[model samples]
Target chain A: MTVAADQPTALIRLGRFLRDNPVIPLILLLFVLIGVLEYMRPGIVNERWIGNTIKFAIPLAMLAACQTITMLTGGIDLSVGVVATVSAFVVSSLTPLLGAPSAVTISLAAAVLVGLVNGFGVGICRVHPLIMTLGTGLIATGCLQVYQRFVIATGSEIPSFLEWLGTGRTFSLPNALFLFLPFAALILWGLARTGFGRLLYAIGANENAAKLSGVRSWQVFLALYTLSALIAGITGLLYVGMIRAPSLSLANPLLLPSVAAAVIGGTSIFGGRGGYSGTIVGALILTVLGTLLTLLQMPEGARRLLFGLIILAVTALYVRFTDQS
Target chain B: MTGFLKKHGWTLGLLAILLTLLIAIRVVQPNFGASGLESLARAALPFAFATAAMAVVVIAGGIDLSVASMMAVTGVTAAVLMDNATEGQAVFAVIAVLLVGIAMGAINGALIVLTKVPDIVVTLAMLFVWEGVALLILSTPGGGAADWLRSIIAGPVSLPFLPEAWTFWLPNAFIFMAVAIAVIWLPLRRSKLGLSIYAIGSDDTAAFRSGIAIGRTRVAAYAVAGLFCALGGLSLTMGTGIGEPVPGPYLMASVAAVVLGGVVLGGGRGGLLGPIIAVFILRAIRLLLTLMAVDPNVTTIVEGTIMVVVVMLGAILMMRERRS
Candidate 1:
């Protein structure tokens, strides 16, 4: 009270402003990082580099977007990567037989089924999200592995349309951005303007209280988790389009990175705070870091080490701000 | 009968499951003899240790996502240290690796306490950090453990008069499990630190108000968990005779075993025997599938289904208990 009433100095106000808005510092830090990288590598910010970064970051951004939703529920979807892989596998396998439209539909349906199972296990049965998703992921991966036997025998091909989707550009924008931007907008609006969005925040903040307040928490969780999985399916399709080939390892590496991105972007892993706005920036920061490190010629081990350290630093920073205010 | 079952339902249930699976295996293949059991035990032992490592932390109301990576690190450490060391030095090197495990665990505990970061986040990062460290130490996994370590971990040690016909050859995993339970887990369960861990897990605020040192106990639990993880890594080293950097699947498998063993994810509600039995049951399921010539792909599906079922059962049981 005393501090607020004192009419603080400009420097103090600036400090408070920076402290209150964590995203600005991140944006500034990203710019500084970009500047440093560009200084080291002259063509670091070229159109080609920018295009590739967006291409690489698209799948991650999608994953991070959905992960933000799940995290807002105070739960995580560890199966996101596996579901995406399954979707890609489905798309690749069925493209020859069903063509693009039906294959994409069937693949997303499978993703939704898997998500529903995860939701039932987590929401209805009240299993921990970590364990529930792990089981579902294992199941999905296992089924895919069995399915791979047939896929190997049949020799599936990536649809030409998907190849275009993966690598195509439209009006000087990467094709992936065209798919991701509107979806991101929908998610952002849903989080901000919808009753379900408020309910998600309520459930995450305190499930019991939400229940007492007449929130059908399970139904919300089911929708949230299913939505997350469907988005993962979309990510997988886009991934298949981008890479032009689908392999088992397609989305495996992105699982942790997606979570890390969300956390970095200011989404509280504990839930009920954060938005897609922060996550988009978070995803971009990670992509920028990856690009910078690659340009710098760092070894994989050093890259991972630096990655872990940065996540730790950002998490600690976030935790401090959340705790303070 | 009801009273006994009520008091030890999870234990009895797990034992019964194990027995039924074994019987099913025997009925399917009468000639599936001691060697099969030996291999099964061998494959399952490392997992059993990993499960124990997880049980310790989970029981303390914390989780260690890094144990699997720690196993890789410990394996890499042993392999690198024993590269040119002689027989006498190898034994000391194993001991040093164990200390390193404890030290790593202590660091995890200390960070959780000092920073007040959730254990899951800290250990999750450590999972990647440890894996990176492991890779840096040995990029492609081509180092060996000492000969004595191998014999100690893998050499035959069957019970007397058990069977000369079927040749009931007990692998060293049994001894490791026994030592882990008898020498480590049981004693720890009786110690003050153990009680403190339980108290904290059950209710931290109440425990703190009751004069228990929350930070120290939590750290001790994690350190103990780390000790088991080190053992797990050693077991891995002995089994493979080389360090391997991939510990991802093992991490998931261990968590599955822990849950299957009836250890609640939230903590303070289960014991070691259940997890030990769960490990064997999972291994048996895999072994049975392999023996039946079932596709290995199908085995993964089965593993996932069983994990979900076991956890669902546990959840139902908890709900019933709460309702009653």
Candidate 2:
């Protein structure tokens, strides 16, 4: 507490350091490089670009935040991508009857339920989160396929009001964007100050030690997993709003990038460290990378290849920069 | 039987699931009687190879999510080469594919050693890279295979008294996999290097203090994993007779299958054969469901649920073991 009180000055210095980190340049790097590559191309960062970027970023950002928290607690919710797929399948399938709000509520519930199962398995059952989540992810994806085939039927788009949640902008900003950054901040605060969040970190750092010290390590882990699933729910709904539809493959490719963003943002997979703030940077950087790749007209294969390389590079950088011990 | 049950409680339990699945298969279609057994063993091969690949690296306390992608990449290489290669060149392609697996695995080890990045991160990256490369190499759904290669993949072992009653009774994938099992498990159990693999997995720094070169050991494990993946690719191509780019997602699923089969995720524990049982169980269940005419979509959900149940059950078992 004494150090923490005096650490605001230190926090400020750290913030300044982060501001000067290569990631800062990384965020800008995509825009400049894309600008030069697409030279004389109209509307790169104009209203259309801004609109798509913000709307597209919402679901991804939420996913990043969810993964960030899991990483904070020394876990990674591999199930998030498939959870999003399952939730989208649920809500999008129900939109015709429940209207937008009710549909979203139902979908979010399903997402959380899936997350809770993951949390239960990992935190309560003490299964490795990666393997447990991987299994849950498969179940969710399978459920998504079933729901898409049965409940959703093919070729159905979400109702109009549903789309507006992601599409409608405030003061010329996307509604999804406005909500995305605030949600990240709130989660970041919880991680920094809340007892629950601290308990999570303590568990991640050293589970046996945390248990010895009287932390309910399992419960804290359970909560972190639930939060991760909850974020996935929110992301799925946002995706429905933006895309107005769902399919078997809707969130299939999301697993790699979501994980990459969190890890690149400096969240350690081994547990007990990292923050969501870096995750946002990681997400933004990835967003820019994707955006640039599309503008460059690269094949899906090459783009994916670059995607893999970037993840390796950033992780290597993180390992070099941080002292894992 | 009770003595058998006591010594092999988990194995017996797995056998129970396997028996139920076999009975279910017999009920679904009578053809499942004989072919079903052969099919179970055959279908189990690729996943077992993939699992073995996954197990090694995981035993070293790292993961390689790219196994499926590398499988695809290697499969693509084999298909393309086998299509055009001469007899000598076919031999060269085999060597090349194995090398690709090793190089890929080595890259994972290098990144892990030098950067201290997590395996999940590095392997996830490689997943993308490999998937992209595979897609580029084979853009469409269909591809070619050598005629001679198909017969071997499609044929069975020459076991004694097993008449040539369609050796289609035993697919070559099973043969390839049986070879891998003995080759890997025997050495792993008896070798110092293999023992060190378990040691590093339990705690790396301690292993380092104990004179294990953690970096080199991990790197070697990953390389071995890559080679197994390559073998899986060859077997998959031979079994199916085509190289499809679709199964890349199944690589991680295979990893999960291994983990589900009682292999520890962070390494140091579990055996090669345990997960091999899981591979057989999963494939048999999937095949039986198909025979039962369940919707493919629902079948996926069923698979997922089974995985969860397995992991959850495994957890409970481990907890009990720890308590005991």
Candidate 3:
């Protein structure tokens, strides 16, 4: 029996390329999907549609970035959505009293605090990431609901600056697109080029080995979770900006889909492998998928079904590829 | 006694905590008598069954996020089927629902085993799929369970000789739990396959080297989990007396119940009893908050805080045990 490795044929080379450059295939998939959508709906080819797609995709992309970093470390943050909501809620509440700058500062600080708590639980206390984050998320949400129900019956206002950032346009392009480009680049470079990124991959790939090699695993986890929480908070702020109002329901729906987006982008949920580059594309794919479903006049049920199938298929492909190597 | 206590110390501690909470509730609402208890039992049944379903999969070292979605699928199926059927066909309809649940679970098991996908990811994706499927089957919830099924599941059964006020005058939910533990958990826990499930959970490589079929065991565990999820779905149907389109927040709630029960998420560390006890404890917490005039939000906040505190305490206990 001849081994494929011994003589690399065209098929083998193509397979190797697909395996090595997962982002390539992901980008291809995105373009192909866009092209199909464009053909189906001519309006999809316009700048307005492009702006709308990017506008909707921004929050998911930001949330996916958080999920990517945490997942790369072999943990997940289910609390990202709630943390974001709490932080945004805090920002909204404070804006009336503290003004825009201070409220934003306080909002980001609130997010950092949530992240720190998550990190402490997962790291110092040795709770599972899922449980720790989940517990914290629940507590935060419960607090929010209580505040809304009893403490404050009325809603808070969104700062104009945030609204502009969230829904503003520059040169006929969504401002969010500009914001995402740099954010994506920073993360993509950090994951691929920075020492912190290497440590993240090392921890995800093998925590014990990393720990033995002098990496303070707990510290790394603390930082990573904090960063994830901060990202979630920022996403919430951006989301509120886009809609020009705060919503309780915004975060819950984003939770599973953000996780889904990260996984779809080729990031391994188990950690170490995958990149933010793929995740950006993944967020785009999800947005396109939602649009396509709506355009097709399919109900939310069909969209969810397709979402599940896509996640399963992408995950299965990654699994198959990784297994062979 | 010391040795036995050391081995089962966590179990005893959990039981103690449960008792303390129950007593506290009774003290707060002294008038919450047997009927209150009955209502609590009825409310706890669906979640108890959910926790049991989770326990089976978690014990086998696999997590099934799809169980909530599975419950919805099965519930919708049962409701849709029975709503149109007469009294004679309700039994067959239920059988069909159970079979569908088992089949869905088997598929999850098969996908995990064959594709080598992580259990969390596979089940997470399936959660979406099943939920979507449920929605597709019944866009709007308009179906109902048969009268007999509801009465049997939610109604209390009288002990022929017992007074109506006696505590032993059991709700059918309690009977359901007893029969489930007897018919499903007890035999399964003692069986060769059950042992294999644990073996694989603890160390799949070792289990395989010892001649256990990893694939078969995992599939069986998931299949069994599916059966329990189907039961949970039925309980939901009976509780509501109708097919509800929205599954609400039971997915995370069930996972929370399992964790509160002290079942290790990565598997192989807990048993069936903890989850069952934990489910009741959770219900009591919700009930306690409601009784205390606490806002719904406050109740959830309190619940989350309690869960975190308990889990942290559990971790502390384990750490201490390790040190000693």
Ranking by DockQ: 3, 2, 1
lDDT tens readout by residue for model 2, A47-136: 766676666656776788777778776777888888887777777777766676787788888888887888899878888887788888
Per-model DockQ: 0.68, 0.69, 0.79
Candidate 1's C-alpha runs over 4 A off are A1-20, B1-4, B158-169
In CAPRI terms, model 3 is classed as medium
Q: What residue pairs are clashing in model 3? A: none
Residue by residue across B1-324, what tens digits does model 1's lDDT show?
A: 999889788889889999999999998889886667778888887898889999989888889988888888898888888877898999898999899899889988887887666787778777877777778888888788888778765645755776744334566667766776678888889988888888888889989999999999999999998888888888888888888876746789889988988788878778888989999999999988888999999999999999997898778777898999
Q: Specify the CAPRI tier of model 2.
A: medium
Candidate 2 residue spans exceeding 4 A from truth? A1-43, A152-157, B1-9, B141-143, B159-171
Q: What TM-score, computed on C-alpha atoms, does each candidate reach?
A: 0.95, 0.89, 0.96
Global CA lDDT computed for model 1: 0.84
Report, for candidate 2, the interface RMSD: 1.9
Q: List the residue pairs that clash in candidate 2.
A: A74-A271
The candidate that achieves the highest TM-score relative to the unseen native structure? 3
Residues A1-325, model 3: lDDT tens digits: 1465576575467677777888887888888989999889876578888888888988999998998999999899999999788767777777877788898998898788889989988887788888888899999898778666642643477888788888889977888766778888899899999989999999999998999999998898899999999889888888888876676666668888888888888888888898898888899899998888778888878878888888888778776764565
Taking the true A–B contacts (Cα pairs closer than 8 Å), what share appears in each candidate? Answer: 0.58, 0.91, 0.76
